[model samples]
Structures are given as C-alpha cells and as structure tokens.
Target: MDLDRALSISAAGMAAQSTRLRVVAENLANRDSTGQTPGADPYRRRTVTFTNNMDRALGAPTLRASRIGTEPGAFPERYEPQHPAADERGYVKTPNVNSLMEVMDMREAQRSYGANLSVIETTRGMLMRTIEALRG
Candidate 1:
C-alpha cells in the first residue's frame, strides 16, 4: 500500500479515537451529577459509536464516529432522604456512570490514538527517506 493511503487511514483512526476520548471525559465529568428536582432524571452517560467507510477521495477505508448515544442500563438508586432530589421513598436516582469503567475506556482510547499516531509518524519517515533517496 502507498504511504499516503496509510497516513490517511491512520489519521481517520486517530480522529475517531479522539472523539471517543471526548465522550469518556464527558461521562467522567458528569458521573456524580444528579437531577435538579425531585423525580427528575439525572445526566445519562453518553456512548460513542464508530463505523468504517470507504473514503472515495483517499481510496482507502477510514473510520469515523457514527453517533453518540446513551447507555441502556437503568440508573441506580441511592437512599438520601435529606437530599432535595430524593423521591418520596427516600430514594434518589443516580447516574449509571462508573468511574472505573470510564477510566478503562479512556485508557483504551488513549492507547488506540497513540498507535495511530505512531503509524502516521512511521509512514511519514518512510516517505521522507524515499524522497531523499530519489533526490540523491
């Protein structure tokens, strides 16, 4: 495969991973967020979805973030009678965001992003060498 095509594919992957990281960060930031009023819903965790498509311009497969959606898991309830957002039964709906899970996801996204960046750097180096050889 051509170096240019490899660079394009890697760039697309890096972009997708960047979006995933952003989504993970948002989830972590809102993990403890609760509803403003009693019986109101709190912040829902957002999930990032990706899809691969053929980039006609690049003539290669590229990845992109398809959509950002909410998780289907039910919100856990915490008993907090004194809290203003608590229900009549002294139970308050808490966001389903888990700190550990978010951390793991963030790590994975970071690793993937780094891998794509490495690929881009390697490809650029090879291209530069090829140009230097041709000139020499």
Candidate 2:
C-alpha cells in the first residue's frame, strides 16, 4: 500500500527486464558467429532466468536474474564445404540463435519494462498528490 514499496517493486521489475533485453541483444549480435575450427561449436543463444527473492531492505519480494544460461540443443548445420569451419562431411554448424524468436523476446522485455516504468510514474504522481493535499 505504500508508494515507496510500489516504486521498489517496479524498480526491481525494470532491472529484471533490462537484463533480459541485454541477453536478447547479445544473442542477436552473435547470431552469425561461427567457430574458427572445423566441427567446432558455434555461438549458443543465451537465456535469462529470473528469480523472486525477498528484499530485506524493502521487506518485499523482488525479481532478479538468477542466471544467464545457454540454450542447449544441436546447432543447425549448413552445407558449406569451402568454409573453414565446415566439418569433414561438408556441413558447417550454424548458431542456434533464431532471429524471429529473439525479436519476439525483445518485444516482450520492452513491454515489461514499459509496464514497470508506468507503475513508477503512477506512484510518483500519487505521492505528489498526497503531499499537495497535506500542504492544503
């Protein structure tokens, strides 16, 4: 019920979403990265996992990025015989990062961040109104 509590919660949410956004950006940037050696693994897409932890200072549960982990799966291979990273079978392992999926994840993170920001703004407005009422 406290405005400060609301602000703290929203701030934690924003921080979590910010980490998600950063992970998405990193995945997109390294989407095309390939290993220099033949049969080597290419870049793996990184994922953000959030956890709800009790904030002793705020006395409320807040969200945080628990870990940044890589997505585990076989990389898609392309027939590129001449490529340095190509295997003996003439197949090159491509990054597991999917552009469309990353874009969707980015959009979701943006929406969450915007929602938290909106809450913070609303809390600020309510606090200002309360101050004015007391002054009157």
Candidate 3:
C-alpha cells in the first residue's frame, strides 16, 4: 500500500537523522578536548552527510547517513602555558568544535527525527482506520 511506502520512507529519514544527532552530541562533548602531547593535533569536528538511495522493495528513494567524516581545518589556539597540550610557544591547540554550532545542528536533527516519527504515526493511524472500516 502507499501508506506502507510512506512508513518506510519516514523510518529511513528518522534513522539518518538519528545518526546526525549522535555526531552532534559527540562533537559537543569534545568541544574542549585537546591532544595530550605537545604540538599534537586536537579533536576535529565531525560531519554527517545524507544521501538518497533507491529502495527496490519500496520502489522509492530513501534517505540515509552517507558518511561520518572529520571537518578539516586548523585548530584554534589558546594561550595556556600550564596545559599539557601546549606547544613550545605556550599555545594550546583546542578542538575545532563550536558549542553553539553543535547545539544548532542537534536541534535540526531532533526536529527532522520528530517530523519523521510524526509521519509514521499518522500513516499507522490511517491504516488502522482503514482496517476498522473494512470490518464494519
């Protein structure tokens, strides 16, 4: 049925967004993480990529988490001479993650997941109603 296809599509979307949420959470948790050794690189922000793939059974394109990769960029430096990760010049390389950006990404992922869940619930409700009417 078309409703079954709807459920499948929405479920795929929810799964993809779930991965995004996890990545965002990890980035936020490591916002202040730094390398232990002098002049070593710190944590890099993670990025999630979404892709649409053909689902043969559903005969439709479904969303998926395509890749989870690190964001390539220079780490921000902080003047912390006492920190173990500090370089010879007294500059510590902090993680590339931004707390505010991670929070925003998290919010977007949550909203996307919630929207997919709502679609599944609505489709299920409609299917149930159809079955109930048929038995009448």
Candidate 4:
C-alpha cells in the first residue's frame, strides 16, 4: 500500500480505539452510580462495537464503530436500605460495570491505539527514506 493509504488505515484504527477507550472510561467512572429515585434503574454499562467498511478512497478496509450498545448483563443489587434509590425490598440497583473488566478493556484499547500509532510512525519513516533515496 502507498504511504498515505497506510497512514489513513492507521488513523482509522486509532480513532476506533479512542472511541472504545472513552466508553470504557465512562463505565468505570459510573460504576458506583445509583438512581436518584426509588425503584429506578442505575447506570447500565456501555459497550463499543466495531465494524469494517471498505474505504473507496484508500482502496482498503477501515475499522469503524458500528454502535455503542448497552451491556446485556444484569445489574447488581446492593443492600442499602437507607439509600433513597432503594426499592421496597430494601435493595438498590447498582451499575453493571465491573472494575476489573473495565480495567482490562481500557488496557486493550490502549494497546490497540498504540499499535496504530506505531504503524503510522513506521510508514512515515519509510516514506522519508524513500524520498531521500530518490534525491541521491
């Protein structure tokens, strides 16, 4: 692939990973969030989904976020009777976000972002060397 095309592909990948990281951060930040009113649902964990699309301009497949969906897992119930959000059964709905899972997802996103950055850097270096060789 051409240098510009390579850079475009890497940029697309970085953008996708950035979006994933943002969702994961939000989930972690709201892990303890509870509803303000009684019998209300707490924050549901958000998930990032990606899809591959053909980039006609670059003549390559690029990754894009298809949608930000909610996690299907059930929310946890905490026994906080005094809490205003508690239901009649004295249980409050807790966010589905799990600290460990969020941390792992964040790490994965970081690594993917880093990989895309490295690809861009390498492609730039190669292009510079090729131009220098042509000058000589």
Q: What total of clashing residue pairs does each candidate reach? A: 0, 0, 0, 0
Each prediction's TM-score against the native? 0.96, 0.96, 0.98, 0.96
Better of 2 and 4 by lDDT: 2
- Minimal lDDT window, size 10, model 2: 1-10
Prediction 1 TM-score vs. true: 0.96
Candidate 4, residues 1-136: lDDT per residue as tens digits?
A: 5889999999999999999999998998899999999988899999999999899999999999889999887778999899999999999999998899999999999999999999999999999999999999
In model 4, residue pairs whose N, Cα or C atoms come closer than 3 Å (at least 3 residues apart or on different chains), thus clashing, are: none
lDDT tens per residue, model 1, 84-130: 89999988899999999999999999999999999999999999999
Give the per-residue lDDT of model 3 (tens digit) for 1-136.
8999999999999999999999998998888889999999989999998899999999999999999999998999999999999999999999999898998998999999999999999999999999999999
Q: What is the model-wide C-alpha lDDT for candidate 3?
A: 0.94
Model 4, residue 120: distance off in Å is 0.5
Model 3: how far is 41 from its true place, Å? 0.8
Stretches of model 3 off by over 4 angstroms after superposition: none
- Clash pairs, model 2 backbone: none
Q: Where does model 2 exceed 4 Å of error?
A: none
Report RMSD (Å) for each prediction in the order shown: 1.1, 1.1, 0.6, 1.1
C-alpha lDDT values of all predictions: 0.92, 0.96, 0.94, 0.94
